[model samples]
Target: MASCSNSNELLSELVCSVCLELFQDAATLECGHSFCKSCLDRKWDSEKNSICPKCRALISERKYMRNNVLSNMADRAREMQIKGETNEKTQIKPSDLSQRAEVGNTDHFCKEHSEKLKLFCKEDETPICYTCVDSLKHCGHNFIPLHDAVSIYKEKLTEAKFPLETHLNEIEELQEKQMQRISEVNDQTKAMELHIKSEFATLHAFLQNKEQQLIQKLREEKERTLKEMEENLRCIKEFSDTIQTQMHDIQSWLEQNDALHILQNITAIENLLTRSQKNFIKSSPKLVKHGITLGVYKGPLQYGIWKEMLSVINPGLTSITFDPNTAHPNLELCEDFTRVKNSGIYQRPLTDSPEQFSLCACVLGLEAFTTGRHYWEVEVGQNNSVWDVGVTQASSNRRGNIQISPKNGYWTVSLRQGILYTASDSACEALSAKPQKMGVYLDYEGGQVSFYDAGDMVHLYTFTCEFNEKLHPYFYPGLKGSAPLKLFHLCL
Candidate 1:
């Protein structure tokens, strides 16, 4: 028994009875025998015996105790190993340290969930914990093991850094370009402002000049009209005085009852009366013959210089006519010739029937004439089939030849020049003569007629006479002579 007891002691010392190896977590069994803590626990469980394995002594089931000293020693060794690994890792360069840190952080705890982030998303390359992996939000998403994913993402991050840096550099370049564009736009805006200001200044000056010219013209016309009115009044008063004198002389002779003296006085009074009557008739008709007058001729006229024939006549000679065969033939008539609403009809030698006849006049200084296009309507008539006649100006000849077709009611004329012409288009014809006074055959209503350039509108000029022949109408320069010209037939 002593020898067996010795052998058992030796065996206990040689091997851990619980672990079956050396006594790594050595502890004493309740029988005062020693064994490893894990091995004894295992033996107790397997045997269903609460007795010491060697001593055969009964042991209480509740007396199992952990060997804290042995556990502490093992914990210390594990700590030393972890520390050695950590120190070795720290020896790596900062760049390598960053790679290690990235892998560590990806498997780190989530800030929001307070759970380990382990599963890595291949798409976004982010780590997710078990909670996130099972979540419906990330269902069907591509994922990989955390460790493997971390290594791959680290390499990707390293590769992406170069492109990211280049992108940042490109961003700076674009910023510079944007700044340059802004500066250029500012400069262009300033230049545009200056140009607009210059144009406005020029326009203002032009308007001022035009205003002055119009004012001057108005003043001159007013003065001339007043003077002519006074002269007409004087002529009317003289005729009245002559009539009164003749009547008084006749009354005195009748009251005397002296036959011889009465006869002599009557004869003398008759002679004086006849002479006075003739003079009065001539002067009175002149007073009643004045017609309406328009302002100066400021528009382009093919021929004829515009002249003020009457005090009220503004600047342009509106119309004129001459014919010897008519009752009122050989007359050169002007509207308001004496400035008394009376017109003057002067008889003159008739012109020979020349091969060609022409008439022209101007409506110069007319404000209605602008840089754009203008239109005019004219009517001409004679006793025979009128040949081709046209209206034209010196500046431009494109809008000249307006024909007055017999089929067309009236001829339309345009003042624009240099327009292209086809077979259907009209060509401008130049006027042969510039006539303040125009000549027409007396076989019919013989007269040259034109429009006056009243700044506000166009006034028609007509020449009519009592004749017995059929009159043919002619229009100088036709636009689309197929259509009747719009007539400004308002009589003043």
Candidate 2:
């Protein structure tokens, strides 16, 4: 009875505190506490931080070992308890003690047949005794030794984990690259901002220098005109003095008492009068003040400056011309290739090539751009009610009727029936004024295609895309009008 009491006390110590039951699949923590593997996992999962269940010590790392010794002892303790409850005897026999000792030697036994589990059912994936092989539940199931099954499954698990590890490594590498790219973008933005500021500063300095030059020129002109007027004033003073001297001489002669002296001086006076009249007519010319004007500076000051700014601009405009090789059959290209007009009739016996457009009345530019900024203007006459202007990828279809949109590698805006619309599924907003001349600006690296009114400098529309190939300037001059589409160099 004392031994039995001692066994009961040991069993209580093996029980799990969380589930209040015998520990199944016992696991031991670093803090020397033990619990069922599942119970401890549940406790840790519900908490933000893992800790020992008994002592509540912080578990920095969730590393635990399976308590194999504790697991065996628990199994024996359970069996012993079950046997003791079924057979109540006050005194313990030697055979009973021997049997109790034998129970601790093996790990698991069949619940129904009380035989050691030695075989694993491959189909059922459960440990079973030899007696269970012929049982109805597992009669036809495939079986292997428990030890061999464990080894095989461990190898399979390791094999499966290799691809997962490789995938994880690849994902981590890509994540690092993405982070580096983000940093590079920020750095580039800062550098670009500084460059913009520096460019504007240069422009400001140029304008300031021009203003000083104009002011200096105006000052010099004023000084020259004033000096000429001063010379004219000196001439007038000299002439006045001569006239006063003549009048005085004549007055003195008139006061002479002798009639003979007066008569003799009359001839001299007449000669002097003739000479004075001739000198008066020739000398002392009247100074008519001419109105001063600022010349071209006074007319279209901003426009003049803007035009002059073209010289300083890094890239003023792209001179684009038509590519006759890509022109449609109904299109007529000028000798210079800068102009295209629809002939209203298809030209026959034309040399056909893969680059030629067979359906749409379209013509591509002679130059193709793959990088940097480019801007060009096309003059679509106001009388032409239908026209199209923009850019298209070099690989875009030229054989059939193509829908002009970004999806089709064509970024364009078209006018139909006197109304303008973007070359997409939707219509663009009404412009303030119709654009007779359309400007196309392409920022290849920036992935932007912008349209503007070349006449008024108004923004028409913009298309954003990721360009991966060569892009060409696109033009479509409808057959309804006799107006020819002409390309011109423009300043930004």
Top-lDDT structure, candidate number: 2
lDDT of each: 0.36, 0.66
Worst 10 residues of 2 by lDDT: 291-300
Q: How much is the lDDT of residue 278 in candidate 1?
A: 59
Candidate 1 structure lDDT: 0.36
Displacement of the residue 328 alpha carbon in candidate 1, Å: 36
What is candidate 1's lDDT per residue for 1-492, written digit by digit as tens?
A: 455334333332334333444445666655556666767677777876676654456787637455655455444544554577323322222223223233233225543333556566655445666656655567788877665653443343344334434433444454444444444444544443343334234334434454345445544544454345445545444444554454454345434533323222333644654654454345341332222222122222211111212332233324222111221221222332211100122233333433112221111111111122132323321211211222222122112232332122222222323221211245434333222211211112222233333332233232222322223222222222122111121111
Clashing pairs in 2: none
Residue 204's lDDT within candidate 2 is 67
lDDT of 2 by residue, 241-305 (tens): 55555555545554554432333244465565564455435643344242222221122223335
The TM-score between candidate 2 and the true structure equals 0.40
